[model samples]
Target: MSNMIIEQEPDDELYEHYRFEAGKGQSPLRVDKFLMNLVENATRNKIQQAAAAGNIYVNDVPVKSNYKVKANDVVRVLLSHPPFEYLLEPENIPLNVVYEDDQLLVVNKEPGMVVHPGHGNYSGTLVNALAYHFENLPLNSSERPGLVHRIDKDTSGLLVVAKTEQAMAHLTKQFADKTSEREYIALVWGNVQEDEGTVEGHIGRHIKDRMQMAVFPDGSQGKHAVTHYKVLERFGYVTLVSCKLETGRTHQIRVHMKYIGHTLFNDARYGGDAILKGTTFSKYKQFIENCFKILPRQALHAKTLGFEHPVTREFLRFDTDLPEDMQDCIEKWGIYSKSHTIEEE
Candidate 1:
């Protein structure tokens, strides 16, 4: 099982905090062995290092890795944040910096740009551009420079980058506390009936498909997430909506929307790429295909971001226009809806 690392804090000296409770029928087991069973990608050596740092606690008492975890005992683990294993290479990529000061910078990130280097993406990320543009920025828990929060590679939006460790901590705290505001504009399949509503669920990686996130409505697994949405416009077949996040779990918006039976239009992963709604008529199918061609990715955009300035402590908000692809897709839908309704009338 993937250990749940609470995203409650970030600093130069940040740590990953996790809490686990022994089951009622759980037999006594070595703490490290018990943890190795629960925490994915964690090695015995790393757990030992944390124990050596007095970071492992059993019922408020620090314990060694070999300590036997008894039934009903609460276990808490804190490990120093691990650095990125790969060396960072600066690349001169253009950045759409909306605002900048000594303490921080606000960027209007374009879609299709990965935020950080990992796996197959070792270059051409936002971090690479930031490293080239700025001088001597601080690294966060993930070892990425300046980034406090990130949107998906296909989601365009405003992101804040801290120039200093203190700024990163402050910004991270705001996000963890849910004080920061993030609003997304999305075009979803089917006409959403409710003018506004909220989706509450736990979001985690799918057991079968590790690449996709699945919603656990019963809270049996995954991190708690909430998404509030209001309808912006309604076409006969699709609806545009604005979503506000109460939690920042990975793919929270996408998974929550899908759970509600209105997956985002053209979202290939969540079954939105096909003709999920609308008529069986060939003309309607052609129109839908044309719209999909215009917008190849999920119809979600991080349109606005609000947070307190890390140094000045003043509330700061940034908003950006939807990129051309999404705008074009919405326009096509609007025209198609008008003509289709008129023909029916």
Candidate 2:
């Protein structure tokens, strides 16, 4: 049997990273054909395409689809999130293009838009918009055309898109090499005790609830993930923080913050929607609920993204302001905190 071992660093847009050790009894076969047997839901065309993109490796060296796999051979594959199950259809969704050129484009994505079609979302995504806006864009392993990285659907922020195959490969290697820079602004429940700290843990899919991810503190399971955070502002019941990712595992910021007992404000999945801190006074309760109404999703924003240009090799960086809902929510907290201090005085 060909058993698989997977490894990854935190918050990466590449969803599935796999390593396979071929059984001693395995016969030589085309690498693409071999992968077709190992990876589920993968078609021969997709596997060949991945090989063409240099996404498949044998013995740590990139290989072509025609390369033959032998007994005990080691193979690795990196596929982006949201499996490529359906043909892409372009949609005319409006995009906030921050920067664009012949090589790539930078977009300031608004909140509540899916990055790609998958699971419950199959239309009106950033990919759909990109497909409509550009023709003949390079397709990544996940079939997300031109997407180098992505933020969560409900999170607002910047993402880079490649316009050419060379750009796609160059950008993917940059992210894989950990040379790209991404920082997020988040509002989490309760005042953070430390001005700055790093959270380290192994994150994997939850055993019982496969839809959610859990951190394994002992390294018994999951991939190594790291998030470095600094306090940006503080309210009595909540705090604002900036998080810099050293690794890009799925849900790294959200899960790490929750693991440290400071979940992102209004993050429903991690229990941040509840009043984890503050007084039980009805007025206080009403205020918290109002803030929830202001920003129904998690208060996280991809505020900054930096990378080297794929073609020009010039270093580039982009920053964006907080979305209106998050801004209004923060302003409300500021006002409430000041009024409460006056009452106590």
Candidate 3:
């Protein structure tokens, strides 16, 4: 009996727990009984429940608890929730709520607030705040309470959270089916030539750097990601654009923009922190540095979000203004670009 246990969180919502390869000499046995013998602390009833939920798989197909495990068959267990690594602690953090009802709520999340607890960020997260504010916010498949989707910590924007299991399921399906609308405002380090364009590629973690995402143009690696961008304003060296997401992947906007030679301004992870486009003059360098100081992080914001209300089926859309830092940075660039263009003429 050869078996391997690999606990991994592939994405935000699914956890892959264990894999077993039955030996050649292995006799047929009920999968539930087999798992009870192998998986520690897993009761027969729990195994049945997981199987009923279609979390148990043999050769990548969902199987019932009574299915006989055959010799050389590959068995795997997947779960909606991860192993309880740490108890979620509710913190009394203030939230900027935009809209709320019995079924769901929309929050205008500010920059520098993490969406959930993970790694070094175990406290001071939006999840922690939600825990404190709401009672019994329904847990999604990933065991996260209320979250249907997430935006990056530094990307200020609107987020809708579900208050019930039905809301969670319906909203999750909307995002997965790409029926939910998500739009972002980004300032990138170049004058985007096209007024509007679409970027299609696969987005995955970088081969060398796990912290950053890279675009796989060949579709060989990563998840399919599409971003539609329309230029909103142009400075001499930078452009402000609105990006609509067709598929949400980690760092999709940053990676896709970088792939198209216009990295988001001050995006440290994607090499936008350095002045990628600008003159070499000391004044120009100082101006860019000041802009970086004002923004401090990637110049991207989840400015708009739209989706069908889970219970009512009414389409809901929310939009927000850019944060003060980004607004100030854009204003300075506008002034600089105008002055620079005059000098050139």
Among these predicted structures, which one has the highest TM-score? 3
Candidate 1 — which residues are off by over 4 angstroms? 1-85, 342-345
> Cα lDDT for residue 267, model 3?
88
- Cα lDDT for residue 98, candidate 3: 91
Q: What is the TM-score of each candidate against the true structure?
A: 0.75, 0.75, 0.77
Q: What tens-digit string does per-residue lDDT give for candidate 1 at 48-161? A: 888887778787567899999999998877555543333677899999989999889999988888887642455799999999999889877666799888877788888999
The candidate 1 region of ten consecutive residues with least summed lDDT is: 1-10
Q: Candidate 3's residue-wise lDDT over 1-345, tens digit each?
A: 222212122363434566788889889999999899898888999999999987787876778999999999988886665555437889999999999999999999989898887534667989999999999999876567998888877888899999998999999999999999999999998889999999999887566554467889999988899999999999868999999999988788988999999999998878999878765678788888998899998999999999999888999999999999999999998988878862462
The positional error of residue 128 in candidate 3, measured at the CA in angstroms, is 0.7
Candidate 2 lDDT over 1-345, as tens digits, reads 222212223243333356688889989999998988888888999999998976787875678999999999988775544334346789999999999999999999999998876444667889999999999899876556898877788889999999999999999999888899999999999889999999999988665554467899999988888999999988878999999998777778999999999999999877888988876678888988999999999999999999999888999999999999999999998988877852352
Best by lDDT: 3
**Runs off by more than 4 Å, candidate 3:** 1-84, 342-345
Q: C-alpha displacement of 290 in model 2, angstroms?
A: 0.7
lDDT of 1 at 253: 88
